[model samples]
Target: MSNFVTLLVEDDALQREVLADVLKDEGFEVLECTTGEAAELIIASTGTELQALITDHNLAGKMSGTELAHFARDRHPHLNIVIMSGTTVKPMPVGTAFLQKPFSPERLLDMVRE
Candidate 1:
């Protein structure tokens, strides 16, 4: 168990599992969710406990990662936001970060560590 709690929202099952595994291995307690809406519920119920939010830009459900991040930020102002997108370069919001797809696990860890 780790002190940091990370929320991972990725609709792709395989990607989600692999990434979640990586975070787990790094001692991060990760809460996995398939959609932005699902993640929203977790954020609502467990706001202060969440230290970070890592989400896919193009989610399977109605909401995008941008929306989720904004909502989470509103609730948890200090939330560490990481947006992963393969389609195009997403505009980085205030106090948020971006990681283009096909990035290495090392890079991901580096961002979270920062």
Candidate 2:
């Protein structure tokens, strides 16, 4: 079976494109966004079938990735969330995943595929 649909939120254009392409190649239907606010909109309107969210912790907008993830989790309790950042994190919600920056595409895929 195909992997579930995923929303990828990253402020960096190149990183967003690369991750989207990699996820697509791995049989995941991918949606891309540039900001946490945009990602929240997608999560709200998506109305199911979106299984995962991969967000950069340091987003361009006022909403950080953790904020977006929390907002999403409230509505979609089962949605898998992955937050990527170079800085240390504290008190993330249960079941959310974290990845440090500069990870390879393969490493990213491994996390998502899990």
Candidate 3:
């Protein structure tokens, strides 16, 4: 089993559960949250212990996933970030990845493990 720790932020419960299950099945430790605010707190508290962050661009809070990604990048320069959205997202933060909605678990795994 891998020791990689990943943070997954998605407001949709079903989507969150599915992705979390997939990641956990693959031996990755997954932290899940429903809003950008919560995710920010986790990021701040966890520091570099978090290896990856996968979040939806349009989140439930004032801070969007893109904003969270930028915040995370500022703190954890080497953290892997994946922003997910059905619509096109322009100008994603530097050094972050984008995963479109309806993507396969394998694709997500690839991005996380990349």
Candidate 4:
């Protein structure tokens, strides 16, 4: 396994499982969660090990993915953050990437690899 830990936050069960499996297959150590709040806890505990964060924009908790992106970026400048959503996110966080819904796994992997 790779040391490049990635945190994936998605409320949808199937989406989270598939994405986590893909990342794992690509040799990334993926930490999966269903809500931004849970993701925040993971990031807080493993920020140093985390290389990337891929989160769905709208979550099932108080914090949204964009909010989580900002928080993670603020604490870990070297972290690569990607916000995925079916709709556009206005004024996306300065140092984060965006993936519109229905994007291919290849595209997502490319973003994370970059």
Q: Whole-model Cα lDDT per candidate? A: 0.90, 0.89, 0.94, 0.92
Candidate 3 lDDT, tens digit per residue, 40-74? 99999986679999999999979999999999999
Give candidate 4 misplaced runs (Cα > 4 Å).
none
Most accurate candidate by TM-score: 3
**Candidate 1 lDDT, tens digit per residue, 1-114?**
467999999999999999999999999999999999999999999957788999998898899999998898898998889999986745656788898899999989888877
lDDT of 4 at 47: 48
Once all C-alphas are superposed, what RMSD does model 4 give against the true structure?
Answer: 1.0
Q: State model 1's lDDT.
A: 0.90
Q: After superposition, how far is residue 39 of candidate 2 from its true place, in Å?
A: 0.8
Q: Estimate each model's TM-score.
A: 0.94, 0.93, 0.96, 0.96
Query: What is the full ranking by TM-score, best candidate first?
Result: 3, 4, 1, 2
Error of 2 at 101 (Å): 1.1
Residue 2 local lDDT, model 1: 65
Provide the lDDT at 37 for model 1.
Answer: 96
Q: After aligning candidate 4 to the native by TM-score, how far in Å is the CA of 90 from where it should be?
A: 1.2
Q: Which ten residues in a row have the lowest lDDT in candidate 4?
A: 40-49
Best by lDDT: 3
